[model samples]
Target chain A: MLILTCPYCGVDCDETELGAGGEAHLKRHGPGSTDEEFESYIFQRENPRGVHFERWRHAMGCGKWFHAARDTATLEVFGTYVAQAFEPPQEIKDKITAKRPGWTWRDVA
Target chain B: MSDVVTALDGATFNGTIAVEDAGLTGMITLRGDFASTSFQNAVTGVSGVNFPGKGEVNSVGDRGLAWMSPDELLMIVPYDQTNAALAEITENLGEEHHLAVNVSDARAVFRLRGNGNVIREVLAKLTPADLRVAALPTGRVRRTRLSQVPAAFWFSAEDEATLICFRSVAEYVFGLLRQSAAEGSEIGYF
Candidate 1:
C-alpha cells in the first residue's frame, strides 16, 4: 500500500502497480575479479534496518524503470529518482541525513 | 486491404453506464526526446496540437497528442489515416533518433458514457487511480491497472471516459467494465 511516485511518469503509484527489483546500486564484479569479490558482488547486499535504496518499475503505468530511497523501518520514502543516475542526488542525500540524523549509506551520507 | 474490425467488433453493453467498443482508432507510439524541437514540430504538424504536459492528453477530433512518458508520446489519429500520419511524422523527423511505430492494430479502445460523473465510479471500481474529479479530470490521462490488466484511460467529459488496453485482452477489459458498471453497482464515491 506504499505510494511511491514514479520519476518518469510522475504518477504516485502504489505497491500493487509496481514491481520490486531487489536492492539497488549493485556493482557487478566480472570475470577478472577474484572469487570472493565475485561472490560478494553476486550475493552480498546491504539489508540495513533504516534507510535503503531500491529499484521499482512502473509495471502498469508508463513501463519505465526508476529508483526509490526509503526507510525500511518506518516505511517513509525519502525520495525517488531516475534509474540512469549512478548515485542518489545531493538534495536527497541531504534530506536523508537531515531526518535520520547521522545516517550514512556506504560512503554517501 | 481488408475491412478493419476492432477487437470486440464494435460490441456494446448498456449497463449503469454505456460501454461500447470504439471501433478502430489509429495509435502511433512515438518515442524520442520531447525537448527536441524537431520532435515537437513533427508531432504538432500531424496532430495539430501542442505538446501536452505530463499526464495531459491534448486531443482534437481524431488527432490527439498524449504524454505517455518523459520521452514518449502517443499520437491518436483517424484509423484510416494511420499509415499516412506515421509516414508524415517519420519523414518529418528525418535524422532524429526516434521511434514511430503503428500501434493501431495492437490496442482496443472503449468508451464509457452517461450517469453524470458516475462514470468515475465505474472506472474507480477497476483501477487503483484516484478517480475523484479533482485527481482525474478532463485532459488528464492515467495509465494504471484495470483490475489485473494494464489499461490507460482519460475523461473526455464529466460523464464519459475513454479507455484503451491491449487488443489481446479487450474482451477481459470489456467484461470488467461491464461488470463494474452493472446496475445497482453505482457507489457515488466520485
Candidate 2:
C-alpha cells in the first residue's frame, strides 16, 4: 500500500484511505472547436513512466484534494503538496532540471 | 430496571453467523482537554492505555486500548469493566479538565470471523480497510469509514480472521456484504 501524504491533514495516509482524482492538473486551451482537441482532452491519457504529477483525494478521512508526485512503475512517492501551493518539493529540483514535453515549471518542474 | 433482550433486526449479514452481546467487550469515548494534566492522568490511570505522546495509538495490556487524535480517544475494555472504569476515572480526575462519557449506548460492536473466503467476502463489501494481510497485518487497528459509517477495523487473534464493525450499522452493512458475496458467486467467484 502506498503512503499518500495528505497536504491538508499533514499526515502520511494509507492508499486504501484515499481515492485517485484521475490524471492530475489537466490543462485546457481556448475554443479550438475540433474533434482532435476534444478527443485529446477527454479520451487521450498520458501514462508517464517517470515522476508524474497527479491529484488525489483523501476520501475516507479528510476530504481534501492535493497533488502527489509518484513514480509510475515503482510507485515511489516523491512528495505531496497542497493544491493551492505553486511550489514543488525541493527534492524534485534535480530530476526536473531540464524541461520535457507537456511540462511547464508550474507543472513538471 | 428489567433487562431487555430484543432481537436487533436487520442488524446482521446473511449466510454469516453473527453474535452480539455474546462476549465481554467495553466501549468508551474519552473527550478531554489534551492540554490539561488532569485529563492526561485520568486516562492513563483508568485503562492503563495512555495517550499517544507521539503516535495515533497506545495500549497497556493486550485488551487495554487507546486511539489518538488531537484531543480525543475512543477507548475499549472488556464488557463488564466499562462502568467501573468510567466511574473510577471520573472520581479521581474530578470535573476540572476531563469528562468521561459512557457511550456504551451510542456505540456497539459485532465480531466477524470465519475460515474460507467468508471474512474476505464480507469485508470487500463493507469498508475500504485493506484486507490485504501485508497492509493491515493481524492485530493492527484503524478507525475509518466503514460502509460510509464511522467505525473501527481490527484483525482478531482468533483461529479464523476476525473483524468487528459498529453495531448500529450491522444490518445494512451485513446486507451489503451478503449481496456482494452472492454477486461474486453469480459471476462465478468461489
Candidate 3:
C-alpha cells in the first residue's frame, strides 16, 4: 500500500486510510464559462503514467484533503502538500524535475 | 433515552489473545483550532485532561482524551455522562468555531489484551500502522483502518490496545478481530 503523509496531521497514512480525489488544481468552470470549458472541468482529466498531481484525503485519519506529486507508474511520491494550495508548490515541482528531468504538469513549472 | 447495548455485550473470546467489548461509553468528537488558547483551555476545563499533541492520549481517572487529528479529539467518559459532558464542552467553547458532537451512540469500543505477540499478531492482519513497542509505545493514539473498516485505536497498556469503530460496523470489526486472533493459533506454512 502507498504511504501518504497527511499534510494536516503529519501522519504517514496508508492508501487504505486515504480516499483518492482524482486530479488536483482543477479550475471550476460555471455559468459564464463556455461549453468546452465546462466539459473539460467536469469530465476531462490527465491520467498521466508518470509525474502526476493528485488530490487525496486522509479520510480515516485527519479527514482533511491534500495534494500529492508522484510518478504514477513507479509509485514514487515526490511530495504531499496542503489542499488549500491552488497549484503544486515550486519546491515540489523542482524535486520532481530533479528526479524525472524535463517533466511538467500543466501550468506547474 | 432507550437502554444502550455494547456491540459484544460482555462477550469474550478466549484464545491466545483476548477480545472484550469496552462496553457503552460516552464518546464526544470535539473539533476546533488546537492552536487556540481558548479552545485548549475549554477542553482541559471540561475533561480535566490536557490537550493531547498529535497521536497522544491522556487519561484522568476513567475519562480519557485522544488526539484524533490536528483539529479533532475524542473524549471517552461514562455512558451516562454523555449529555452532561456535551453541555459542559459546549458551554466552555463559548464563541470558538468548534463542534462538540455526542457520538456515544454512533461508535463501539473493544479492548484487546494478550501475551506473547498475540495483540501485535492480530493487529498486523488489520492495520498498516507499526505496532511494535519501540514505534508505537503505550498511550499512542493511531487513526487507521482495521482491515476495510476505519477505526481509532491506541495502546492503552503494554500488550493491550483499545479500538473504536463506527457502531454500524461494530459487529463486523469485532468478528474480524476474533477471526484474526483465531488465525494466530495456526502455524503458517510459509
> Which prediction has the highest DockQ against the true structure?
1
Q: Which candidate do you rate higher for lDDT, 1 or 2?
A: 1
Docking class of 2: incorrect
lDDT tens per residue, model 2, A1-109: 6888676545567777788887766666448658787777787777777667788987665466888877776787767877765556665544444333344433455
Worst 10 residues of 3 chain B by lDDT: B181-190
Candidate 3 lDDT, A41-96, residue by residue in tens:
99999988899999999988778899998889999999999999998888998898
For residues B103-156, write the lDDT of model 1, one tens digit per residue.
Answer: 999999999899657888888787888887778879999999999999999987
**Pairs in steric clash, model 3:** none
Tens digits of lDDT, candidate 1, A14-33: 78999999887888899899
lDDT of 3 by residue, B104-137 (tens): 8899888898763667767877888767766677
Q: Candidates' DockQ values?
A: 0.75, 0.14, 0.68
Residue A2 of model 3, lDDT score: 87
Best-fitting candidate, scored by TM-score: 1
Better of 2 and 3 by TM-score: 3
Q: What ordering of candidates by lDDT runs from best to worst?
A: 1, 3, 2
Error of 3 at B137 (Å): 2.3
